[model samples]
Target: MRKLGVKAAAAAVILASPAAAEMEYSFYIGSQSAPHSVLSGTIDGTAGTAIDSTVAWEGRSTAPPPYYGMRGVYWRESGWGYGLEFTHAKAYASDADRASLGFDSLEFTDGHNIITANIHRRWKNQWWNGRLTPFVTAGVGVAMPHVDIQHGGGAHTFGYQLTGPAARLGAGVSMAITDRMSAFTEYQFTYSDNKIDLDSGGTLETSLITNALNFGISYSF
Candidate 1:
């Protein structure tokens, strides 16, 4: 009887471990917006003189390279979870800003991508027949942006580069459509500090704060 009790207790502990928890995968499309920021750096040929200019940015979320994200999470029975997420966000300098700043083209439209490790918490509620759950997440990550910049008769820098550090916070509610499927809408705020290399032979630095509204579906296993 003693041996049987010990074995039963061990089995219970095993079942309670996070290794037995649920894994969730989610995909989302979103619209993103950012505020004006100063782009400062040394352009190629002005004898290494640094210039500073305030740039107005446009989201253009629905344009050719749309905003999107994906995540994979592992949720414990205690409502705490951890995950990894990747978001493809974008920014473009406004035409007026381009003219004022004397740049032919400046954009990160192919994307300002962020990859993060996140911690999440959710509350179980007796709403919508117990299918509604509200959750929040916080993460830290890095920014890898495709730098596309051009100045009047200068080298065009166009490629992916590791720019800087990024962080994000989000809140959302998910409604279960089935035992293994859920639909969600979320609001996220992300901040990235970019120090990007210019092809003409210098570095451009800028900080971006972006707000996004996302709609998505998740599948759990």
Candidate 2:
């Protein structure tokens, strides 16, 4: 009964938050970018794999989704923000090419993601755009990255609890379609570290960089 009480209290806090500057249901779709760093481990600077597409679920500084996992929003500086995301991708390598030399002689694929609890502040228009303003944010959170590899009858998966340091330089625009609702789109760049085992049994540490150019629709209450 105590566990249920704790859950109820948390839910009450979320329902009590006022609209405007609160996190609504926000969804995103994009691709995993090259690995970058304040540290190192990126191949050829900040470009690694091709494109591992993904879909993410994000909520603002409100109650988190219970059915999805432990993901929600919080405060950082003076504003509110959250980056609750998860994704998967797949690829195929030729088994007939001369480049197959000593490889598994089959397809190679991987899937990875991170649920970063970043903080953000939304601003009204500054110049003359009327509904657009350049907003900036910076925060840190947990980065749990995972990868899976398959060959013949064997499959390998690597994952861990890592660190996430991120920054957002983007602009947003919104207009009221009704009295209590608005919609917007934002473009951002996100960065994180990668704990990679490019090949089996050979562990390599590096930072994986991701550029998030996003389009989103939200309904505020």
Candidate 3:
């Protein structure tokens, strides 16, 4: 009976102790930018029978909005962690650029869905009574770019979906709200090597670089 009592008391003490490691889930919304403009093919012939070839275009072509994503992380008391994430964004062609492409309104949309595995290191210094933590992260992953091209008046449409490898570097700060929750903001730069083939006898090679800013809340358990 004494041994049983001692075991029960030891179990109670262990259960009351704090955990040395934790897992977190986070969701965030932010802006993504592809700041380079795309060019169209060159034009041949003259007058009404002129043919247009690829031309070097300029300016940003995507709509202004924030992209959202989610992440799952496993962190230890020793300041090292690893995570998995998924994110998405969209891009479109400008109307004037479409007219320059020899169509009434030739427009294209780019939809990207990416999955990544990341490793991070956190700094343990506290600015506001252990509420703040700073981190740096880097990772390599894969992306699927889904492209849709179409005419303005429902004349024709084409889809070119391709998958490729990608890499990213990022930094962020997290502020604690409670024992199990926190808020964070991060900035990341991503580069991808992607290529697409048009149905009309041409190919587009995209070695793209983009920047992103994100803010969100995280829950730890």
TM-score of each: 0.94, 0.50, 0.71
Name the weakest run of 10 consecutive residues (lDDT summed) in model 3. Answer: 41-50
Q: Model 2, range 1-221, lDDT digits (tens) per residue?
A: 99999999998877655433444444444332332232223222245322222212121111221111122333232355665543221222333431322224221123234455545565544445454434444445444544433323333433343434433344555444454344555555545554554433333344454455444444433
**Which of the numbered candidates is closest to the native, going by highest TM-score?**
1
- lDDT of each candidate versus the true structure: 0.89, 0.39, 0.65
Model 1: per-residue Cα lDDT at residue 37: 93
lDDT score of residue 160 within candidate 3: 39
Which regions in candidate 2 have their CA more than 4 angstroms from the true location?
1-23, 30-32, 35-110, 125-130, 150-155, 158-171, 197-200
TM-score of 2: 0.50
Sorted by lDDT (best first), the order is 1, 3, 2
Candidate 3 RMSD computed on C-alpha atoms after optimal superposition onto the true structure: 6.1
List RMSD in Å for every model shown.
1.7, 12.4, 6.1
Q: Rank the candidates by TM-score, best first.
A: 1, 3, 2
Residue-by-residue lDDT tens digits, candidate 1, 1-221? 99999999999998778566899999999889978898888876446647698888888899988999999999988889999999999999999998877778889988889889999999866477788999999999999988888887688899999999999999999999988899999999989999988889878899987899999999999
Q: Residue 217: error of model 3 in Å? A: 0.8
